[model samples]
Target: GATDADAAVAVAHPNIALVKYWGKRDEALFLPVTGSLSMTLDIYPTTTAVRLIDEPADVVVLNGRPAVGEAYTRVARFLDLVRSRAHRTEHAMVVSTNAGPTGAGLASSASGFAALATAAAAAYRLDADDRALSRLARRGSGSASRSIFGGFVVWHAGDGDGTAGDLSSYAEPIGGEALDPALVVAVVDHASKAVSSRDAMRRTVATSPFYRPWADSSEIDLVEMQKAIARQDLPAVGEIAERNALGMHASMLAARPGIRYLSPQSIAVLDAVLALRADGVAAYATIDAGPNVTVLCARADAARVTAALRAVGDFVDPRTAHLGPGATLVPGED
Candidate 1:
């Protein structure tokens, strides 16, 4: 049903990795040191449209303003990849909008690039499968590979076997419908991060002594996480996710000069999550490279989790999200 078109718009949602993807094995290829498992959230969808224009240069507009700095560079570079694949030299205009804050640990880049990759593939008439698109999205953001699928997904680290190994690094969906978990996203802060995640990861990999140990343990965590999801064990899933995320932060914290993304507000939310769990609620906390925290709990406990998070009085807002669908090309949703 999908074919080449003059222009196309696509939508995708961000995915929060439970087993945490911290450092990259291949920086240029965006391959992780260890594989990761995640749940694609139903919230914060990114919509992007790409249209070929008869212009000398590509144009990029993000969230209602002309993209500048790293944002513009990433979009243009990703487009270059698509151009090379499609074998079309025509420049294009890319317009994108994110429903939530970008680069603030909300996985905005994940959804943004997934949507862009889908749109570009369709616009350029590149007949590629979902796995192929996942690889394409990974060029823009490491986690974006998982955004290609819905529900629970896994991104394989593949091998370090050069070009052939790169093919194994795409994300794929793993069934977990029975879990039906809910994620309560606590937004403590939404401002742009001073240090980008990529930079932070590089620093941690290069400097932190804890990085290797954590990376080693993460592989075992991934195995347990997959088992937990397979058996529909919400508490196990939550616990593994929380500890893995905390370990990721620990590695970052141990970096030379030490980098910290968790603020007082972030810790407050985390404490609340623990409190909820102690109070007989199946809840656990996970944080990304930024200050915000996401609470994992059973679907039935989402409202209670949200209320408890709000009572912490630290977050700007807290909302519940469920499993989301994969990226898709929309005819007019843009």
Candidate 2:
């Protein structure tokens, strides 16, 4: 039997969406308005360890520091879900570490919650398969569901109605074995964003006139992206990725206050991507809810893309990421 002191650890990698997930039809359940697809990156992994404690409150330590406020509360609430499932009243101590920058729209939360959900389930003795675990992670962050799988993954938004909606929303892997792709992560600013993705997404959905158009087009993008991946068409994939990301930003820009995640340096990288395309290299850029830009290119062209972005002389440090593995439990640790 699993005891309150039994600890479990798991590691997960962050994934960048090719078809973005922006709005939520059910915010409480973290159900997205549309489906999304992504590629798990080789860089920026999060390792989390969880253990049930005999305390009245949960204790969380994030990246070696005592977490407070929203960060602590978020982890505590996630644990509450695990507790409810296990039928245990004991609290927990969660320690999470991120290999890359947290926030900054780099999908840190995706990795964090994925790792947390897996470890907490194991520590608390909850019997769950990957799909069940994906749903658990989705409760923490919509994108976290995709982190449960690696290489190429697609997250179904599920039906919007509250009746058994969560079961329909889960992430599954899309094979890309014959494909060799790379994501060049250009970090313009590593600091956390002024507005969180959750708030920004709601504002865009509520205020932006372009939101509906973007959401509708995202469905088509998801279909075409899957086709492109199946045939390993790098150019077609890049083209769809670039336009889809730009459209997402356009919807956000139409918001009342205008959520601009792209900075001048981000544009510089985008321009460099355009220049690379002009020179016969297939490259495309995407930005999440932060100033950082992720450029998708061929593995053979990754060095070229990295050099081109470095030539801009504005990015802090650029990293080229190959497709990474899915979430896995840490071996030989109890």
Candidates in order, TM-scores: namely 0.97, 0.98
Candidate 2 per-residue C-alpha lDDT over 1-334 given as tens digits, one digit per residue, 9 for 90 to 100 = 3364478899999999999999999988898999999999889999998877777788999999999999998899999998899887778888999999999899999999999999998888889999999999999999999999989999998975675788899999989757879999999888999999999999999999999999999999999999999999999999998899999999999999899988888888888999999999999998888999999999999999998988988555799998998898897656
After superposition, the stretches of candidate 1 with alpha carbons farther than 4 Å from their true spots are 1-5, 332-334
C-alpha lDDT values of all predictions: 0.91, 0.91
Write down the RMSD of all candidates, one decimal each: 2.3, 1.3
> Which portions of model 2 show Cα errors greater than 4 Å?
1-5
Q: Model 2 Cα displacement at 285 (Å)?
A: 0.5
Report the lDDT of model 1 for residue 98.
97
TM-score (C-alpha) between model 1 and the true structure: 0.97
Please provide, for model 1 over 193-245, each residue's C-alpha lDDT reduced to its tens digit, 9 standing for 90 to 100.
Answer: 88899999999999999999999999999999999999999989998999999
Candidate with maximal lDDT: 2
After the best TM-score superposition of candidate 2, give how far the Cα of residue 47 lies from its true spot, in angstroms.
0.6
